[model samples]
Target chain A: MRNRQQGRVIVGFLAAPVILYTVFVASPYVQAFYIALTDWRGLSAEVEVIGLANFAELSGDPVFWKALLNNLVLLVTLPVVTIGVALFLAFMLNAAGGPRSGEIRGVRGAGFYRVVYFFPYILSIAIIGVLWTNIYNPINGLLNGALRAVGLGGIQPSWLGDEKLAFWAVLAVLVWNGVGFYVVLFTAGIKAIPASMLEAAVLDGASRSQIFFRITIPLIWENIRTATVYLGIAALDAFAVVQIMTGGGPNDSTQVGSFYLYQNAFSYGRFGYASAMGVVLFVVTLALSAFTLRATRKERIEF
Target chain B: MTTATHDRVSPQAAAVGPRRSRSARAGSSGPTIVVAQAFLVLWAVVSTVPLLWAVISSFKSDPEIVADPWSLPKALRWENFARAWDAASIGTYFGNTVLVVGGGVALTLLLSAMAAYVFARFDFRLKGALYYFFVAGMTFPVFMALVPLFFVVQNLGLGNSLPGLVLVYTAYSLPFSMFFLVAFFRTLPGEIAEAATLDGCGEVAIFFKIMLPMARPGLISVGIFNFIGQWNQYLIPLVLVSDDSKFVLSQGLANLAVEQGYAGDRSGLFAGLTIAMVPILVVYALLQGRIQAGMTAGALK
Candidate 1:
C-alpha cells in the first residue's frame, strides 16, 4: 500500500513541471534544428524543407559573419580583461593587506568594497544598457562632462556614433557589469586557501606579488576556470546589451550573433534564416564550453 | 538573510588571522596598504558614479541636464517622474511586471520544489535520466529555441498575455531551480522525514507539512534568485509579449529610453530608468548578502 502511495506521489509531483518543461523548453529546442532546414516565413502555416539553403545564405551574409567575429573578439577579450581586473581586485580585497603581526589580512573595509562593487551585477541588463548608453552619450554625458571638467574636452569623440569605438565601448560595459561577481567569487576561493600556507610564505620572506603568483593563483585555478567558461557563455549572448544600447547600429560595428538572430527572426520575419544562425551559435557555444573545460583542465590541488 | 551572511563571513574571519599564532605575525609599511585602499576606493567610485549621476540628473530640467551635467538641480522637479509614469505609461509597465514576476517566481519555486523533493529522496528507475534531462537545459542556449518557442506560445493562445509571460519565465527558470533545490533537499537530514513517515503521514502530507518547511532557507535563496532574474528579464518578454500595455519593466524601460531619448525628454528618460531601478535597489540594500549568495551559490556548487 505504501509503495503504491509513493508511486502516486512521485507521478503527481513530477507531472506538471515535466509537461511544462517539455512543451515550452525541451520541444522547442528540438524543433529549432528541424526548422533551420525549412524556409518558414513565420507568418504562414507553410514551411518548405530547403536542405541547408539557409546555411548557404548565412555563409555569404556579411552581417552574420561580422557578428560572429565580434562574438569571437568578446570570447577572448571579455574573459581576459574582466578576470584580470577581478583577480587583482579580489586579491586586494581579500589578501593584499599589509601583514599585521605576521597574519595576512584583507584591506580595511573589504566587506564594504565588496558590496559597492557588486552594485552593477544586481541591476537588470536593460537598466545597465540604458544607464551606460546615456553615460556614453556624445553630448552632455557624464564621461565627457568629467573629461571637460578636467580640461581634456578636445579629445571627446562620439562614443556610440563612432563605429571604431562603439564595439569597445559596449565591451567595456560588459566587463564593468561582470567584474564584481567574480571578485566576490574569487575572494571566496582565496579565503578557502589555508592561512598556514600563506603565513609560512610570509615567514620565508616572500613578497606580496610573489606570494600572489606562487600560492594564491595556483589554488584558485578552479574558480578562474569556472569564471572563464561563464564569461565565455556571457560573451556569446551579448544580445540584451547590444539590442538595447546600439540596436546593432553605428554601421553594425557591434552586431553580435544573438542580436543578429533576433533581428532576422523578429525584425525581418525570416524564421528559417534565424534558426540557422541559432544552430551555429549553439554549436559554437558548446564547442567553446568544452574547449574551455579541457584547455583549463589542471591537476586538482586537494586542500 | 542574517544567517546566510554570518555563515559566509565567520569562517573567513577565523581563517584570515588567529591571534593565538603570535609567532607567525609579520608587519609591513603603511604606504602599500594606503595605495591599495586608494585603488579600491577609486574602483568603488567608478562603479557607483554613473548610477548616482542618473539619479541626480532625473531631478534636473531637460535644459539643465544638457547644460550642466554635473551640477545639482536648481530645483527638485518631481514632475519628470510624474510625466514618465502617466504619459509614458511606466506605471502600467510596473504593474505588469509585478504581476508577471510575482506569479512566475512563486510557480517556479513550487514546481521546482515538488520535482526537486522527489528527485532528492525517491528511489526510482529513469531518475538519473530525468534529472539529467532537466540539467541539460542549463547549457542549451535559449536563443536556439526562440523561433519555435514564439510559435509554440502563439499556438497555445498564450501569445501577448501576462500569464503566458509567467509560464515562459517559470519554464526557463526550472532547470537552475531544480538543480539547486535538489542538492539543497539532499543536504537536509532524513531522520525527521523518516519519523514523520512512521507517524502515519502520507507522502504528500509529509512534503507539504514537513519537507517544504525544512527546505525554507534553500527555497528562499532560490526564490530571490528567480525573482531578480525574472524581474530583470528582457528577451523572453520582448519576444513573447508585443502588446504595449503588457510590457514588463525591462522592455518598457528600453522603449522609454529610445522614445524619450529621441523626443528630447532627457530628464523623463532618466526618471524612468531611476523608477525602474527602485525595487532592485531596495531589495539589494535589505538582503544583499542573500542576493550575492543566491546568485553565486549555483556557480560554486
Candidate 2:
C-alpha cells in the first residue's frame, strides 16, 4: 500500500511539469535543428529541405558576421571590465575598511552602497533602454546637457546615432547594468573568508594591495569563475538592449547575433534562415560555456 | 614560501603587531579611502541620476525640457502622467502585465515546487535522468527555441492570448526554479516527513501539509526571483503577444516610445516610463534585502 501511494504521488507531481517542459522548452530546442534545414517562410504548410544551404548563406552574410563580431567583442570585454570593477568595489566594501583594532571590517555604510549599486539590475531592460536613449540624445539628453553644463559641449557627440560610438554606448550600458550584481556576489564571497586567515595576513605585515591580490582573489576564485560564465552568457544574448536602444544600428554597426536572428525571423519572415542562425548560436553558446569552464579551472583551494 | 618565511621570522608572536602597524596603515588607507569614496560617490550618482532625471523630466513640458534639460520643472505637471495613463493606455498595459506576471509566477512556483519536491525526496526509477533533463534546460539560451516555439504556441491556438503567454512563461521558468528549489528541498530534513507518514498521512498529504510549509523560505526566494523575471520579461511577450491591448508593460512602453517619435508627447512618454518603473522601485525599496539575497542566491553555487 505504501509503495503504491508513493507511485501515485510521484506520477501526479511529475505529469504537468513534464508535459509543459516537453511541449514548450524541450521540444522547441530539438525542433530548431530540424527546422534549420528547411526553407520554411512560415506563411505556408510547405517546407523544402535544402541541406547545408542555410549554413552556407550564413558564412557569406556580412551583417550576420558583423553581429557575431560584436557579440565576440562583448563576450571578451564585458566579463573583464565588469568583474574587474566589481572585484575592486567588493574588496573595498568587505575588506578595505580602515582596519579597526586588527579586525578587518567593511567600509562605512557597505549595505547602503550595495543597495544603491544594485538598483539598475532590478529595472526592466526595456526601461533601461528607453532611459539611456533619451540620455544619449544629442540635443536635449542629460548626458550632453551635463557635458554642456560643465562647458564641455564640444565633445558632446550623438551617442546612439554615431556608428563608431553606438556599439560602445550599448556596451557601457550592459556593463553598468551588470556590475552591481557582481558587486553583491563578490562581497558575499569575500565575507565567507574566515576572519582568522585575514587577520593572520594582517599580522604578517601584508599591505592592503598585498592582502587584496594575495588573499582575497584566490579565495573568491570560484565565485569569479561562476561570474565569468554568467556574464559570458549574458554578453552572447544582448538582444533586448540592442533592439530597444539601437534597433541593430545607425548602420548595422551595433548588431549582435540574437537581435539579428530576431530581425530575420520576425521582421524579414525568413524562419528557416533564422533557425540556421539559431543553430549556429547554439553551437557557439555550448562551445563558449565549455571553453569558459575549462579555461577558468583552478586547483580548488579548500577553506 | 611567503607563509613559511613569515612563520620562521615571527615564531607565532605577532598578535600585537597589527596595533603597531595601525598608524602606518592609517597613513596609507586614509588617502586611498578618500579616493575610493569619491569613486563610489561618482558611481552612485551615475547609477541613480538618470533615473531621477527621468522622474523629474516627466513633470516638465516639452518646451521647458528642450530649452534646458537640466532645469527643474517650473511646475509639477500631473497631466503628463494622466496623458500617459489614459491617452497612451499605460493603465491597460499595466493591468495586463500584472495579470500575466501574476498567473505566470503562481503557476511557475506551484509546478516547480511539485517537481522539485519529488526530485529532492523520492528515490524512483529514472530520477537522476529526469532531474538532469529539467536542469539541463538552464544551460542553453532561449532564442534557439524561439522560431519553433512560436509555431508551437500558434499551433496550440495560444497566439496573442494572455493565458498562452502565462503557460509559456511557466515553461521557460521551470529550469531555474527546479535547479534552485531542488537544492533547497534537499536541505530540508526528512524526519518530519517520516513522522507525518507514520501518523496516517497520505503521501501527497505529507508533502502538502508538512514539507510544503517547511519549504516556505525557499519558495519565497524563488517566488520573488520569478516575479521579477516574469514582470520584466520582454523578449517572450514581444514574440508571443502583438495586440496593443494585451501587451505587457515593457512591450507597451517600448511601443509608446516608438509611437512618440513625431507626435511630441515626450513628457507623456517619460511619464509612461515612470509609471512602469514606480511599482518595481517601490517593491525593491521595501524588499531590497530579500530581493538581493534571492537574486544572488543562484550565483553562489
Candidate 3:
C-alpha cells in the first residue's frame, strides 16, 4: 500500500514537468541534430536529408573560418587576462586591510569595494555595448578626448574605427566587464582557505609570492578551474556585444563564431549551412568543457 | 606532521606570528602595498567610469559632448529622455518587457520547483534517466538549439506572442532551476514531510503547505537568477518575436540605438541606453547582496 502511494505521487507530480520539458526543451536539442543534416530553411514544409553537404560548405566558407578564428583568439586571451588580473586583485583586496596582522581582513572598505567592483557585471551586456561604443567614438570618445587633453594629441588614434585596434578594443571591454565576477569569485575562494594555513606559511618564513604560489593557488585551484571553464564558455559566444558595437565590421575584424551562425540562419536564411556551424560549435564547446574538467581534476585539498 | 609536533608548533606560531611581523611590516610594505592599492583603485575606476559617463552624457547636448567630452553637461536635457521614451517607443517596449519577463520568471519558478521536488524526494522508473535529462540542460547553450526552437515556436502557433516567449524561457530555465533546487531539496530534512505524511495530509497539501515555505531561499535565489537572465534575454526574443512592437527591452534598446545611432543624436542615444540600464541597475543595487549570494551560492556549493 505504501509502495502504491509512492507510485501514485510520482506519476502525478512528474507528469506535467516531464511532458512540458520533453515537448519544449528536450525536443529542440534532439531536433537540432536532425535539422543540421537537412536542408530546412526553418519555414519549409520539406526538409531534404542532405547528409554531410553542409559540413562541406562550412569548410570552404571564409567568413565562417574568420569567425571561428576570432573565437579561438578570444578563447585563449580572455581567460588568461581576466583570471590573472582577478587573482592579483583578489589577493590585494584580501591583503590590503589593517596592520600586518595575520587575520584575513580585507582592504579598507572591502565590502563597499566588492559591491562597487561587481557593479558592471550586474548590468546587461547590451547596455555595456552601447556605453562602450560611445566611449570608443572617433569624434567625441572619452579615451581619445583624454589623450588630447593630456597634450598627447598626436598619439590618439580612432580606437574602434581602426581595423588594427577594433578587436583589442572589444577585448578590453570583455575583460573589463568580466573581471569583477572573478574578483568576487576568487575572494570567496581565498577566504575559504583556513587562516591557519596562511599563518603556517608566514611562520615558516615564506615570502608573499611564495605563500601565494605554494599555498594560496594550490588551495584555490578548484575555483580557478571552474572559472576558466565558465569564462571559456562565455568567450565562445560574443554575439550581442559584437552585434551591437562593431557589427563584425572594419572588414570582419571582430566577427565571432556564434554571431556568424546567427547571421547565416536569420539574416541570410541559410539554415542548413548555419546548422552545420552550430554542430561544430557544439562539439567544440563540449570538448573544451570536458578537457578543462579533466585537466583541472586534482587531488582535493582538505583545509 | 605528527600530533605531538602539531601541538608543539602552536607556541612557535604565536611567538613568530603577527606580533613579530608588525615590527617588520611597516618598514617593508611601504611601496608594494601602495602599488597594490593603487592598482585596485585604478581597476575600480575602470569598472565604474563608463556607467557614470553614460548617465551624465545622457543629459548633455550632442555638440557639448563632442566639444568637451569630459566637461559637465551645460544643462540637463530632460527632453533627450522624453524623446527616447516617446519617439522611439521605449515606453511601449518597457511595458512589453515587464509583461514578458515577469510572466516568464513566475512560470519558470513554479514549474521548475515542482519538478525539482519530485526528483529530490521520490524514486520511480527511469528516475535516474529523467533527472539527468533535466541536469543536462544547464550545459547546453541556447544558441545551439535556436533554429529548431524558432521552428518549434512557429509550429506551436506561439509565433510573435509573449506567452510563447514565456513558454520558451520557462522551458530553458528548467535545467538551472532543477540543478540548483534539487540539491536544495536534498539538503532539506525529509522528516518534516514524513511527519506531515503521518498526519494524513495529502501530497499536494504537503508540498504547498509544508515544503514550499521551507524552500523559500532556494526559490528566491533561483527565481531572481531566472529573472535577471530573462530580463537581459536578447537572442530568444530576437528570433522568436518577429514583430518589432512585441520586442523585449534588450531587443528594443538594440533597435533604438541602431535607429538613432546613425542620425547622430548622441544625447537621445545615450538617453535610451540609460533608460534600458537604469531599472536593472536599481534592482541589482537594492538586492545586490541577495543576488550575489544567490548567484555565487551555486558555485561555492
TM-scores for all predictions: 0.95, 0.96, 0.94
Q: After superposition, which runs of candidate 2 have C-alpha atoms over 4 Å from their true positions? A: A99-101, B1-25
Q: Could you tell me the lDDT of residue B78 within candidate 3?
A: 99
| Candidate closest to the true structure, highest TM-score | 2
Error of 2 at B94 (Å): 0.6
Stretches of candidate 3 above 4 Å error?
A1-5, B1-26
**Per-candidate RMSD, Å:** 5.2, 5.5, 6.0
lDDT of 2 by residue, B92-206 (tens): 9999999999999999999999999988888999998887888778888889889999999999999999999999999999988887889999999999898888888898888
Candidate 2 clashes between residue pairs 3 or more apart in a chain or in different chains? none
In candidate 1, what are the lDDT values of residues B51-149, reduced to their tens digit?
Answer: 899899999999999996888999999999999898989999999999999999999999999999999999898998998899888888788899999
Of the true interface contacts, each candidate retains a share of: 0.77, 0.73, 0.55
TM-score of chain A of each: 0.98, 0.98, 0.94
**Over the stretch A37-119, how does candidate 3's per-residue lDDT look in tens digits?**
88877574577999999988888989888898999899999999999999998888885443344454566667777787887
Query: What is candidate 1's lDDT per residue for A30-114, written digit by digit as tens?
Result: 9999999999997665989999999999999999999999999999999999999999999999887643445687887899899
Candidate 1 docking band: acceptable
A144-245 per-residue lDDT for model 2 (tens digits)? 999999999888798999999999999999988988899999988998999999988876777888999999999999999999999999999999899999
In CAPRI terms, model 2 is classed as: acceptable
